[model samples]
Target chain A: MIAPALHLDGSARYDGTPVFSDLSLRVPAGEWTCLLGPSGVGKSTILRLFAGADTGADFDGSFGADDGAPLDGRMALMAQDDLLLPWLDLRANVAIGARLRGEAPDLARAEATLARVGLAGMETRRPAELSGGQRQRVALARTLMEDRPIVLLDEPFSALDARTRSQMQDLTAETLAARTVLLVTHDPAEAARLGHHILIMGPNSVTPVAPPAGPIPRPVDAADVLGAQADLLRQLRGLPE
Target chain B: MSGWRAGILSALLGVAVWQAVVWATGLPRFILPGPGLVATTIWKSRALIAEHALITMTEVIAGLILGTVLGALSAVGLAASKWARTLVRPMLVFSQAIPVFALAPILTLWFGYGLGSKVVMALIIIYFPVTSSFFDALMRPNRDWIGLARVMGASPARIMWHIRIPAALPGLASGVRLAAVYAPIGAIIGEWVGASKGLGYLMLLANGRAKTDLMFAALIVLAVFTILIHAVVSRIATRLLERY
Candidate 1:
């Protein structure tokens, strides 16, 4: 399948205060694009717009695929919070998207996805029974089960410890390789590690920065990855570079 | 100790204290019958007490089922619509304001001292707690879960049934527990107003005839019945919560 490009142009205001204005960005097909910014710079808001999950935000925008089709039902979002339904077991939670759409949940496929996320034997466990990272992995399994062309992630791994985060990053980079992925995060190192192209979000605009020449997740100790990280830090801190 | 054992132990201790109180006060059986006297009355009048107890049980169980179903539906209606919530919430609160005991006589008069009045009374008593508790819970589903469901294209009705209802069940269970306790009170009050049957009427009749032991026996049976109802309702509620 040919991955569809996403273009979004909008100005958004929350409670009559403008969060961002005249923001425009393009997510190329089948590439991982990381949106790096400080907290509360509306990185997550942008993802919400793409996910069509924006609530109470007055937004004026047009979001469409490269072929000029609306993005509805074509994209799936993994929120900052894992957003696992507490009452559901791991397998049921992974199958919820299908169930919600009035389609019969494929329990077999759900179990397979859970196994892929390394939660093979814990299908019957509730979301509360798992640790934070495990819960996030279950959420990832849910997103993977969605299997949409566009995947929007909002700080999906912020709660994990360093080692687990690295493992998850590798899993995501490999699993979501062919999908158009837009990840929002405040961590420069995470952006350097996972993004094919990193976009530094400012007050009213997003600036694209060229990434190091390698497929992600790149090593944190790689020279080019470290150089990109330093450059991103400078950009975030507004220091002369 | 387990709950059942602890409950039985406490009940025995309570009877011992009661017998001691009767011994120290030197009260006659005509005034304050001792635990042994009450036990004897219970055994001798078992048939009479059981007949009345069964009538009261039927009223309470019928009312519990009807009130729970009606209250749960109302709570769902109120939670789903802004208009219903704005219009009906104050009415629900107002319904509770009219003293329930005062309505007992009116209900008995209207329903003609039959089972109808007692069932209606029990229903009215239980309705408010169930609706208010369940509605409060429905109104405040986990925000993150709701958001995720919305993003996944869940309709409002779907959210209400699949998400809100399941999430709010524990609250509904709590309301049912309160209703279970209150249901017996309603039925007894209605019976006291004008009933020829039920534990309440038996107590009143025994007191009029100076049968203090029989009255005490009926009261004890009623208390035990209430405790049993509460226990059963609690067990069912816990199971429902666990299943969902």
Candidate 2:
């Protein structure tokens, strides 16, 4: 039997302002879930909650991973910021999490992961030495070294040029394989392209975009998902009246 | 113009102005010896002045190493605890307020008339800058850099050894340069109080005997040691901190 990927129920807020409320959702193992919304609509907030950054905040929520354990090595998160250590060269940066885990052959795993993310042969360059696209690729490479069942990406391609961005999206699609991916992307086309299911977040709620016969998928029709997001927004806006 | 050429031209221009002033004013040699006379005296007494200068040099080097280690430890202690920081930092700040002259007497008394007192005085003088610079350096890792390290799952110890210490190298080197310059001067001050032998001792003897040229020559020796120490330290600093 497949374990549940993640479950978020109830509201999460910042300061006193409500961000997401009564927003219960579940992602199954090996499925990609895209959190789609306009800016300031709490898409990023949901990611943070799932990643366990929302500590001591004014919120009422139960976020439980499979097996009832607080999400630990079972999940890996990559923020929009690459956050590479300036002092370390590339290979060491990717190996950091493995080193933290005290795993042997961590450097070898790091190198393999680097190759998986299309960052082959650039292991010795410092963060400053790499281009922005290269840095993000390194970050994505680092994320893969975790080999966790779940992965979170927050606007990972927002900084890349279109060619690099498309390459990254392709790299992400290939590298992630069937991991439970919770992606926060503003690009409707991107959401339509890669998401297994689109969750439109707005009006402080995560409302699933009504699907076709099956889950939304890579090579999906952008117009279809964009129309779904628009309809969801309309439905949410109407509720305020 | 090339930097070296410009430096040479500036030096010549200054010396020419000095010679003109000396000739125009007819100032007594004891009061304001001309650069030429000083140079000649330095060349003539180079061996004697250098012997005493070597003692001063040895004192500076020893004091500098001892001071740096003590200062670095104090910085680590201050950074390690809030109580230490509160107690130690203000005391360090107020330390400068205590006249070095007043403190010199006490340091000499405690350590005594041996070269040990001079070394202690140098350590005291150099300690302030080293501690302050190290404090700034150590605290730097506690900022956004640490955030990156934590997010990458780097343990606190790894962060300190790899990122924090390496990052602080630049500031630490700068502090070392400042301390090196002060080390010799601080030793000389202790020597002035009452030393049997040193460049300072030689200067006192020369002054008492009305050996104006010898006094000027000793001053040149001190200057040479200062420049030599400064150059060596600066070179090491450049090599160590160029990465940062």
Candidate 3:
């Protein structure tokens, strides 16, 4: 029995501002888990914390990955900003993580990954040359190159057009099939789109509020989802009052 | 568009007025040669003017390369370590404060009135602007970028090499342009103070021999050379920064 990737229990803050506190969650192996919250609820910070991004004393947590799981090196993270190297083209950017790890045949794999994103011809175009959607796709392609068990995605497709965003979600679902994916996003539609178990980050904490539990066959339809996006939005809206 | 054109036309008008003043006053050729006379003189002495111009241009290019390399290296060094910044920063600022005219004489005394002295002079003139500009650019507040890179576990070397260096391009380009203008001027000044060759030396020699035309020729050559260098460097940098 391959156990889950992580069991988290803790809190984090910023300059006396409570980001989220006393959070607990279980991220299983080979499953997509989306963390949903409104803007500034420290969803990104949790992704950061999970990715070992905590600087200073902002985080208090208990995180332990399953032993001997054979993750390719370790955790790989993607952030909200689409932090692709501006100097690199699509191909080079995709392979950067593998190159960092001294992985064999990095560029070849990076090229194939870029092809998966339909960016085959844009291997030489820099990040500044790419559109918002293209850049995010390139970033997703890059994250795939890491070949790691855990992939932390932080609002990666938030800037894309609806069509592109849905297509990207489809591509990511197909391509990142086996990874323990933790995606930080504000949009419930997106969380529903990913069709994973959900972790909703709350005012003072994050609670394990999975999407009705058990396997929900993904490429999930908006109407067939357990939580309607409008309901979630209203729930979020009514929380602080 | 009209405003820019008008400003340029006004400058040409100012030049025409200056030309008229020189002609009407009948000022001594040594004191203030007329524009027409200078133009004719430059045409006549173009070959000789070009030879001296090449010498000055070469010196300027060499000094520009050396000073920029030294300045950028110093900026990196200072940025890399607080100890180096403490030790070297005061000297750099103080060096800029000491009048270039004052420094020129001493440099001539040390490097013996030749290429070395002139190169050092050019270096002294353009070094501070480049060093300070690049230093400030390199250290510019990039909290988001720093946070991103740190979270990604980028090594310090990688962070500086990739992030800081590319981010500093705009400031570095401005500094390069400033240095390009001043580098030739510095070389000319050094040659004016003491040199066996170059347009500045030729201008002085031409003046002594009462060849006012030849002196004007040298001055025009200097102008063309400065424009050419600045344009070329700017184009190359812009192309390189396409990726940046």
Across residues A17-85, which tens digit of lDDT does each residue of candidate 2 receive? 777678887776787887877777777767776765534356686876766865655677776778787
Q: Compared with the true structure, what per-residue lDDT tens digits does model 1 show for residues B22-44?
A: 99999888899999999999999
Query: Which 10 consecutive positions of candidate 1 chain A have the poorest summed lDDT?
Result: A47-56
**lDDT at residue B217 of model 2 (Cα atoms):** 83
For model 2 chain B, the run of ten residues with the poorest summed lDDT? B142-151
Local error of candidate 2 at A137, Å?
1.6
Sorting all predicted structures by DockQ, with the top scorer first, yields 1, 2, 3
Flag the better candidate by DockQ, 1 or 2. 1
As for lDDT, the candidate ahead, 1 or 2, is 1
Report fnat for all candidates as fractions from 0 to 1. Answer: 0.43, 0.17, 0.10
- Candidate 3, position A57, lDDT: 44
Q: What is the DockQ of each candidate?
A: 0.57, 0.31, 0.19
* Candidate 2 runs further than 4 Å off: A1-4, A9-28, A37-64, A99-105, A210-241, B80-83, B142-145, B151-153, B242-244
Write the residue-wise lDDT of candidate 1 on A86-182 in tens digits: 8889999999987888889999999999999899989999998998888988999999998888888989998889888988898888888899999
Instruction: Give TM-scores for every candidate, taking all chains together and pairing residue i with residue i.
Output: 0.93, 0.83, 0.85
